[model samples]
Target: MATASAVAAPPGEPVAAPAPVPELDLDRYLGTWYQLAAVPQHFNLACARDTRATYALDPQGNISVYNRCTTWANTVNDITGTATINDRETGAQLHVSFPGVPTQDRLDGPTNYIVTALGPDYSWALVTDPSRISGFVLSREPALDAQQWNRIRAAIETAGQNTCSYLTSPTTGGRGDIAPLCST
Candidate 1:
C-alpha cells in the first residue's frame, strides 16, 4: 500500500488542475496496460499481484475498461467499466465509470481521470485526477528500464504529483519490488 493517502497542495494554496497531454490517440491507447505503479486506492486494496487493465472500443464508440488483479489468496478480481471522453478536442481527459464502483461513477463531478503525460511512442503514460489526489503509472510492459523510470519520475513531478505517493505494483514476469516511486 502507498504511504500517503492523498497528494494535495499546501494549506490555503490554490493549485491549478493537472493538465492533460496535448493530445491522445484513442486507437493507440486502447490495449492492455500493466499497472507499473499507482497511488493506492480503496478499491484496489485487495490486489496483490499482476494488476493490469485492458481497454477496447465498444459498438457505441465508447471505451470499455476491464481491470483484473490477483489477490493474496490467488483469486482473480475483475471489474468492467466505461470511459467517456471529457475533452473531445484532446481526448486526453476522460471520466471512467465502473458499474458497481461508486468512487469511479461520479457523473457530475470534475473529470476524475486525466492522461497528464505519455511516452513519445505511447508505450507509457502518467495519469492523474483533477485534484491530483489519485495517480497511476502505466506501461506496455510489466517492467521498465532505469532510463524509462527516470523519465516517468520526471513526468510525475511535472504533473504536480508527489513521487513519494506512488507505490509500485507487483506483476508476474515483471517487477514485484513494491516501493515508493520516489525511492527509485
Candidate 2:
C-alpha cells in the first residue's frame, strides 16, 4: 500500500522529499500553536521560553503569521509574516514570507512550509521545509505527554528526519528535562 512518495530507499541512499499531508483545512489550522520542539534556527536563537505562533486569515485571503517568544533577556520578540498556499489541491504546501527578516522572505519561490503530519483532531502537527533543513513540532497545548512525544518522534522518522536535531522548546508547563526530541 506504499505510494511512490512513501517508498523507502536502499540502505545508505538518500530518501525522497518529504510528503505533505493529503489535505489541510485552513480554518482548522488557523490558531495558536505552541512550539514543542524544533530544529535550531538562527532566528529562534534568542528564544528562551513560550515560543508560539498564531495564524489568521488576512484580508487578501493569505494566512497571517504571528510568531512570538520570550527572549533570554526577558523581552518579548514578535514578528509578523504571511503565508500563501502553493498547492491549492492539498493546501498543505505553502510559501511563507517575513518582511525585513534575513533570508526568510521567499514567497516567489517554491513552497517551503509543508505540513508533513497532523493529529487527527488538529491538536498537533509536524512542519518542515522542502529541503528538510528546518522542522517544528507544534501542538495546541504547551506540552505533550510521553505518548504524544512518541507519536511525534514516529512522525519525524516517517518524514526522513533525524529526531536528534529537534531540541525541546521551553514552555511554562513543559517538561522539566528539556532535551532532543529523540530523548524526550
Candidate 3:
C-alpha cells in the first residue's frame, strides 16, 4: 500500500511565482522509477514507503505503467495504468490515471507533468503538474544517497517549490509520519 500526503495547492496562491518547466529528453524518460517523495494522495495511501513504478510502451502506442507498493502490514499492492502523449510535438506533457474503476474517465486534462529537470542517465526525475497541484521526486531506488538527494532538492528549489510544505515519508512505524522535509 502506498500512502500520500494532503494535496498541495498550486504555486503562487499565497505568494511566490509559479515553478518553471524544464526541457525534457523523452527518449531517456521511459523506464522504471521509485517514488521517493510525492505530494500524498488518497489513492496511494496504502503504500508503505518503498513504492515503485515501471513504464513501457504499449501496442496502442501509449506508455504502459505498473505501480507497486508495500503496506505497513507487509502486503503488496499493485496497479496498472496507461499514459498517452498529450502533444506529439512537444512530448513534454502527459496524462495518467489508474485502470481500476474503469468507468471513471482517465485524467486526460492537460497536466503540468513537465520534466523540469532530469539526470543525465535518467537516474533521477523531477515531475510536477502545471498547476503545481502535484509534484514528485523519483529515483531508481527506494533510498537515494545523500548527494543525489541534495541534487534533487536543489533542482526542486530551482524550480521554485515551497520546500516548507514538502513532507518526508517515514521508513518505519506509525500510520505514516508526515513532517516537513525542509524548513522555510
TM-scores of all predicted structures: 0.90, 0.90, 0.74
lDDT winner: 2
Q: Where is the poorest 10-residue window by lDDT in model 3?
A: 1-10
Q: Which structure is stronger by TM-score: 1 or 3? A: 1
Which of candidates 1 and 2 reaches a greater TM-score? 1
**Predicted candidate 1 versus true structure: per-residue lDDT over 1-184, tens digit per residue:** 2223234558797667878999999999999999999999988889998999999999888889999999989999999988889898899999898876666665334588899999899889999988887899999988898989999998888887778899999988878778999887
Clash count of each predicted structure: 0, 0, 12
How well does model 3 score by local distance difference test? 0.65
Ordered from best to worst lDDT, the candidate numbers read: 2, 1, 3
Tens-digit lDDT track of model 2 for 15-116 = 766889999988999999999899999989999889999999999999999999999899999999999999989999998999887676765557889999
Query: What TM-score does candidate 3 reach?
Result: 0.74
Give the whole-model CA lDDT for all candidates, comma-separated. Answer: 0.87, 0.87, 0.65
Which run of 10 residues does model 1 get worst, by summed lDDT?
1-10
Clashing pairs in 1: none
Superposed model 3: Cα runs more than 4 Å off: 1-23, 101-104, 170-179
